[model samples]
Target: MASITLKTPSLSYDIHIAAGLLRTLYPRLKKLYPAKKSFRPIIVTSENIWALWSKDVLASFPEPPTVLFHPVGEKHKRLAAVEKLADQMVEAGADRDTLLLALGGGVVGDLTGFLAAIYMRGIPYVQLPTTLLAQVDSSLGGKTGVNLATGKNLIGSFHHPLAVFADTNVLATLPPEELRAGLHESIKAGIIYDPKLFKYMQANAEAILAADPAALTKVVAASVKVKAEVVGLDEKENGLRMILNFGHTLGHAIEAATQYKQLLHGEAVAWGSIAAVQLAVSRDALSEEDANKIVNTIMTYGPLPQFRADAKRLVTLTAGDKKRRSGRRAFVLPKAIGTVEVVYDVTDAELLSAANSMLTLMKAQA
Candidate 1:
């Protein structure tokens, strides 16, 4: 097992990475937190996981803590749903001292962490992420957010969790598409911070897709460590964190164009990444080879799923991207594998051309 601590302005938390962690949750949490006369927990999960792993997790609690289950997916991540969860906590008599157990993937982690952040100004929470995406990226960072109708993650706050419980075994049950989608974020982390990881994936693409145990742990652990270091430095995203949105600015637009239902976040990001790479080269910020390397990485991670999306409408959606500024459609484009540039001055014509060019490349490859 490996451990990392995230120190942020509003919160501090430990990330525990290991296999078979679901069974150890009780004993370990009990040690980390000895049962006092007053301590209690409130478990928050998505409807998907509650049906799958609720028995083992709930049974482990001394007196099964209350769990508020939200219907799963990015669509449900909204203010109304969060308010409902907070109301449930208050109705259950939860206090600031009570711990929050977030027992699902990134959606639940983001929603729950945000709930914990706003509830009574904040409360401690644990992250038991079952999805690889959450295990590798979202579960470690204090960045919590919900989508607004106008933009993806247009509303959010930075609130770290008390602990992260990543159980790799749980991923074995994930749908193959979901598993492939997670690789997009993993690939983004590599592109932003660890060029060596990009090389490693190049060599182990087959094994990674197969989900070999050793590869899973190493990739997940390394990805988490990289994100942990970044968030530890800038929790509020006031400076360096925007680079984490590498493909996300345009990706969010792609998501919104599709109503966030057609493509997984990763899939949208994959295509969005395709556009980001082209923009970099078109602006001469990077060599053509660099763009090709990125495209290859996304392909190696997983071939982008086919979807019929309108190009012009997607470009319009970028105007509302949080990263956009001065009313320009912008993005974080890579200079190389491990570094990126956040350029919000990208022209609308450039964005549409890039989006169209990417669709051309995708079609050619398909």
Candidate 2:
């Protein structure tokens, strides 16, 4: 097991990453949250994930604390679901001492963490991420929130988890499409921080895609370490944290414009990075060779699912991005492998041009 501590002004926690970390839940929880004092954890899981791993998690709990079932998806990540989970905690007579054991993917971790942030002002929480995306990105960050009427993750808070158990074994059951979606984050981590990791991933794409235990473990640990370091530096996303949003501005737009149905978060980001590279190169920030390399890198992986809805409306969706400030969208564009920047003065024309280029690339591939 690889353990690391995440310290922030608001909260501090430890993240345990390993192939079978869930198997250690019983012993770890007894140490972290004693049944005699703490309100114990309330396991909030989605239907699908519950079906796959609940037996193992349940067996570990014995008395098993309390359990809440939230619908699985990006769609249910709203105040309604958060409210429902909060209701369960209240119904069970949970107090501030209570902890929410978020046992699912990004949706569960985001919504449940929001519940912990607002429930009785705040409560402790733990993240047991089952998906690669969550394990590497969402669960590790203290970012928690849900969507609103206007945009995706527009209404959210920075609520840290008390601990995270990233069980790599659980990823074996993930659908291939879902796993592909997660690869975008791994790719993004490489683009923004480590060109070497990107080269390794590109060379070993097959093994990574096949969920080879050793490859997947190293890939996830690399991405998580990158994110953990960023969060530890700028816990509130004041500045440095925005770099973590590489490809996310347009990616969120793609998700919101499609109502979160057209593409998974990672899929949108994959294509979004392509779009960003186009803009970066066009603006003279990156060389065409670098742009082509990034695009070809994605092409070698696979075709990016088309998101050809409305470019203008999609750009408008970026207005609601979590990183927006002073009525400007903070767009992160790649300058080269292992480097990206958050540009605050992005023009609508630039965004439109890049998005159109991305559409053209996907269209040609299609």
Best by lDDT: 2
* Tens-digit lDDT track of model 1 for 1-366: 878777776666788887777866776676656557355788888777888887767556666778788888889999999999888888999997788888888888888888888889988778898888889888878778898989887788877776888888888888888888888888898888988887787788888889888887888887887888888777777667777888887788888977778888888888888898888888898888877887887887766776677778888887788765556555788999889877757788888888998788878877
lDDT of each: 0.82, 0.84
Q: How close is candidate 2 to the true structure, as a TM-score?
A: 0.96
63: Cα error in model 2, Å:
1.2
**Clash-forming residue pairs, model 1:** none
Every model: Cα RMSD to truth = 2.0, 1.6
- CA error at residue 308 for candidate 2, angstroms: 3.6
lDDT of 2 by residue, 114-158 (tens): 888999998888899988889889998888999986788878887
* Global local distance difference test of model 1: 0.82
Question: What TM-score would you give candidate 1 relative to the actual structure?
Answer: 0.94
